[model samples]
Target: MSSDPLPSFPFLNPGEFRSICSSFVNRVTGYSGDLRTLGWTNVKQDYQDGSAMLIISRIIDLPQWANGEQNDEGSCLQDDIEDDDPEMLIRPSSISGTSKVEMEYHILLSPTYQVPVLHFFFKNTLYSGPNALEIVYEHLVPPAYRSDLKQVGVMGGISMTNHPISGIPVYFIHPCNTASALQTVQGKEAPTAETYLPLWLGLIGNCVGLYIPKELFASLRNNSDD
Candidate 1:
């Protein structure tokens, strides 16, 4: 491996980061959910098998919007505070006439890290004249430096709980480390393999995001039953 230190990338503000992270979470989880509903038994396994490659590809593309590195002259930072009429703002046709809205957030990984972790944040609301919010996190795991195989994981947690505006569900996944079995050529610190696995997995599934709907939660429980 090259002796050079890993590359460094820009960091995003909390709101921007959260937005990207949420979207990623929703996409990955939604995909998983769809597969589960379709009775796909090996969805997780197949996902793991390809996650490394997918992550690397994303790293290379490094979309500006995803990382909040756009040149919009700070348009992203500005919020619509003065608008008295929500209708004044252009809304997607899909959400027209419906109070329900969904928003996405992104989290960028450190470029220098051998294994990158990206978080996707999602917000879902149901129309009821009151703003209801649901949050979810999608953790992205890229392959370790110089590794060919993809060793990705997904876990979910709850950030808040209350009413139709229940808290967000956060997901945690592991990235490659130098010292562990999924060692990286560029990593220096070796995360404790024995302890980190379960801890990471549980955190990914339990503490990161809030679970909504007993039915959805029940499905998750059953899926892990085996």
Candidate 2:
């Protein structure tokens, strides 16, 4: 058996994080992009200035009604919308049907929190209407978790900040209470490196619209039983 020890929940050491990230990269390979109808793609591990991270990309379709333009009345909602409120002042644009936008996600271990943090942004440059944060709130944030994610500076909120290494402005789901949040779903059993990421993605990734295929989980189960 390998000598590596399994990582503890709520926190992950650098070595353990790398091991889990590598396993995650492999699991997502050939299972995303054009290979699957609805899944992430461009999965790989990369390093910059000695830090390791996992990167993945996907194209998401937004319904025409997802537009965030203000109505002709020229009124706008207050900037201080309550954290518990998911309702937004959005109006449909002239565009019809659905529109696609390519989104990229960067998963890196946080030095302070000792947990994985997700940084993501869409790839379009010319597209304009609302800022990244506004777009995320309007189209990506699920109504179920909208309130919790609005509580910035606290757990369960989506934070808009600059990338630690790249210095690029990006949006990330807060990792502050990731451990406690994960504990609720992880149960009493210790999680293996192979299993950690899928669990993390299920609990955390969904905040920003990342979802793993159910069939992939079934495939992993079958492989483990062999």
Candidate 3:
């Protein structure tokens, strides 16, 4: 981790971080890239305020443990979606994980701050409550981030919510102002790939029962041109 700010985000811009995720998802799923750059910044999530949010997101394949019948394909949203749009980008349907095991990742950035938020949605499953989240927080995340989830609107912290949409519940995990959580190997205080990516993959992957070694992220670090 460098003394410089946000060693985690190579370009210090959310867009670049978005591309990094795009590349990572691509490598893991082997699917045609469907990453979407959201149009609005004020997109609402539980326990969050409307702010300058630059978000890049996508819905990808789920872990096998997220067992359930895959939902039927959504009706064509061509009329509602933008041209060249890989997926629907309008209405609540703009997000694809309805009544199924949808793995959605959102990389969020704010103009007023440098550290970004790591947010994801685990939708349409039985794991939709504070109890489930407690199991994850206590077992998966490090002690430093164990308390982060309780701070919903804090600048550099984390939060969790089990909110339902149209009676369909989803589990949401949000890590805000992530720079504050990055502690280096040498006992330095900095946010770098050495720290951020492992923590992100660990907590999120554990909830889905996926194993993601930090070494697997080498592709993302090398593919900066994306």
Candidate 4:
């Protein structure tokens, strides 16, 4: 007797894939008044690690602040200074760096499947408390995807506890066929807790298809000032 070859998984077109991603984000954050809202549900019960809780808790405790308020201390600024020499006076002597932090989340979706894979990187100041950001991306496989072993077949690996930069916890929803880098940072050091929180929240929102509230972003900025 001959065995039949495995059936190929249906590939999702760009429009279909975007729709699926949009639906996924809406389903996850639909309950929240704002996308930036953080609650116990956001943290998966089975995946609770203390560090993740701490980061979420701290964000919940921050006060509301606006994005462009003068009180906002994290604003990016450029300065021009002149020297005594004629050419020097015409042109600035040197460039001065300011305080700021940035976090990047990279999502890679393959042609074989619909679900998008996620990776993250963080850049912060040296004086910043912790150099890493704790991030978790969780997804419940749809019934259709679960039924097919060849299609899903352990597409992802187990979550990791520590990522580069900050020894902070890093978690993934599924493993990909090829190993990919998760978090990375190229800067003086990790960002402050306050600045880090907003960036982190934004990254989560992007993965889940939530709309981050401008007010919430402001709050993070305001808290960083203090």
TM-score of each: 0.22, 0.77, 0.39, 0.26
How many pairs of residues in model 3 come into backbone collision?
A: 0
Q: TM-score of predicted model 3?
A: 0.39
Give me the runs in candidate 2 sitting further than 4 Å from their true place. 1-7, 30-34, 63-97, 126-130, 152-155
List lDDT for all candidates, in order: 0.26, 0.67, 0.37, 0.30
> How far is 33's C-alpha from truth in model 1 (Å)?
9.5
On residues 2-108, what C-alpha lDDT tens digit does candidate 1 reach at each position?
A: 11221221222333323333433333464435433332222111122212211101111111222222223422212221222344232223322212222222222
* Candidate number with greatest TM-score: 2
Ranking by TM-score: 2, 3, 4, 1
lDDT of 3 by residue, 1-226 (tens): 2213344442256444444344344443432232232111122222124333322222334223323222234322222121333322211213333242334434444344444444444433333333445534543345554454456422233345322222222344443433443332223543343334445444443333333533344544444224
- The candidates, ranked best first by lDDT, are 2, 3, 4, 1
What's the C-alpha lDDT at position 127 in model 3? 31
For every candidate in turn, the CA RMSD to the true structure comes to 17.1, 7.5, 11.9, 19.4
Across residues 74-188, which tens digit of lDDT does each residue of candidate 4 receive?
3221111111223311212233432222333333343454323443322221111111111112122233333332243433432434432244433333434322211232133
Better of 2 and 4 by lDDT: 2
